[model samples]
Target: MKSLIVVDCQYDFIDGTLACENAENAVNSIIKYINSNDIKVHYSKDWHSIHNGSFKDNGGVWPVHCVQGERGARLHEDFYKHVEKDVKRPKEDNVFYKGIDDEVEEYSAYNAENSQKLSLKDALEDEVIVAGIASEYCVRETVLELLEAGHMVEILKDGLGYVDSEDHLKNLQDLMERGVRII
Candidate 1:
């Protein structure tokens, strides 16, 4: 079965505190692609707690963002609208949340679980088309995890962003070397 793994395209990753470079530009294309596809769509949220080491100020690597119930944690409005409208099918229960733990950080959506405790690896059958913010971060981590789980992952190149250009290219190279296909 085909699945579209949409990583954190939330406000915090796009235009909020931890915004990625050019992340905003991918919105329309992502929306069009999701609405036009017939396969299952998986949306991942970086639902965090109020305090965590994931924030630089707290001694973690990243800035503070995506706290649960916060505005920054919400998905980009337009992209989320597509999820709300399209993820209603009985077989379409793929919206998962990650990065919620205050102690250990989980960048991959596969690390998160649905209400039923199903991870993406459990929910997905075969192939996945990836799209989301920060190509060098959450999106990259999720794709690597999916690939390790034996899923065929094809990243939508134009639909991703990165905080650092050089690291972005390096990460893409790493994915390609690991048999991930870029579209």
Candidate 2:
């Protein structure tokens, strides 16, 4: 069995505080991919506190986004509409969250845990396919971490969006060079 991990498709990274080009566009691609029956789907996000080093309010480069209990911290509406209610899709009861700390930039999905306190590493198989917003950030880190965990990892290219266009291309190339498959 293969796992499909969707990294940080939150409102802040989509059309809110840290919005980037094409992040919203990749939602449909992710939706389409998750609609398939062969894989287990998981979601991750930046569930930040009020004060963080990654927030401009502190000393980080990014604007304050994905704050707890805020609408901007939530997932895109369409993502839910497309996959949340379907009985046929993988049973998606876990939403892994990271960056709960105010000072760390915990980008990997491995840093996350669900409502039941289950780690993504425990749920995953030997193979994983990753897709999500900010190709140069969370998505990239999650894939790299998966590789470190000894999983055969693949990236869903069409299902990715980038914060930096040039870095996005470079990161994709770097991942490929490291033997991470692109699909």
Candidate 3:
């Protein structure tokens, strides 16, 4: 079975704090892809608490964003709408929330879990396609984790957002060299 992993397509990474370049376009492309595909879809979100170590307020490098229950933590409106409209979609049950622990700066969705306590790694199939925000960070880390776990991973090239275009391209190249297929 092949699975689609939508990584961190949240408001904070789009238009709020830590917004990335081309995030809007990436999100639109992701929505289109989801609408066009019949594959199983999973979403990863940064559901951080106020005390999450990744926040600047907590002595981390990033500004406070994606705090649980906050607007910035919510998925893109259009994406969420599509998820709601599609009965075939598993809705929030397929959402994997990472960065929930206050002390950890979790970047990989592989470390996330759904409300039912199912980890994304456990829920994923052998073949996975990944798309979404901050290509140099969360998306890249997740792809690496997936690869390390022996899954056949594909990256949606046009469906990626990033903080730096050069870094994004470099990461793509590095990932490709590591056997990740960029599509």
Candidate 3's C-alpha runs over 4 A off are 83-90
RMSD to true structure for each model, in Å: 2.4, 1.9, 1.5
Give the C-alpha miss distance for residue 144 in model 2, angstroms: 1.1
Local lDDT at 49 for model 3: 86
- Considering only N, C-alpha and C atoms within 3 Å, which residue pairs clash in candidate 1? none
For residues 98-124, could you state the per-residue lDDT of candidate 3 as single tens digits?
998888878999979999999999988
Relative to the true structure, how large is the alpha-carbon lDDT of every model? 0.80, 0.83, 0.89
lDDT of 2 at 110: 78
Task: Rank the models by TM-score, top first.
Answer: 3, 2, 1
In the range 3-23, model 2's lDDT, one tens digit per residue, is 888888888888887888788
- lDDT, candidate 1, 26-129, per-residue tens: 66667777767777777788888878878887889888899888999987888645544546322325668787678898888877776676776777759998
Structural similarity to truth (TM-score) of each candidate: 0.90, 0.93, 0.95
Candidate 3: lDDT of 41? 88
Give the winner by TM-score. 3
Clashes of each: 0, 0, 0
The lDDT leader among the candidates is: 3
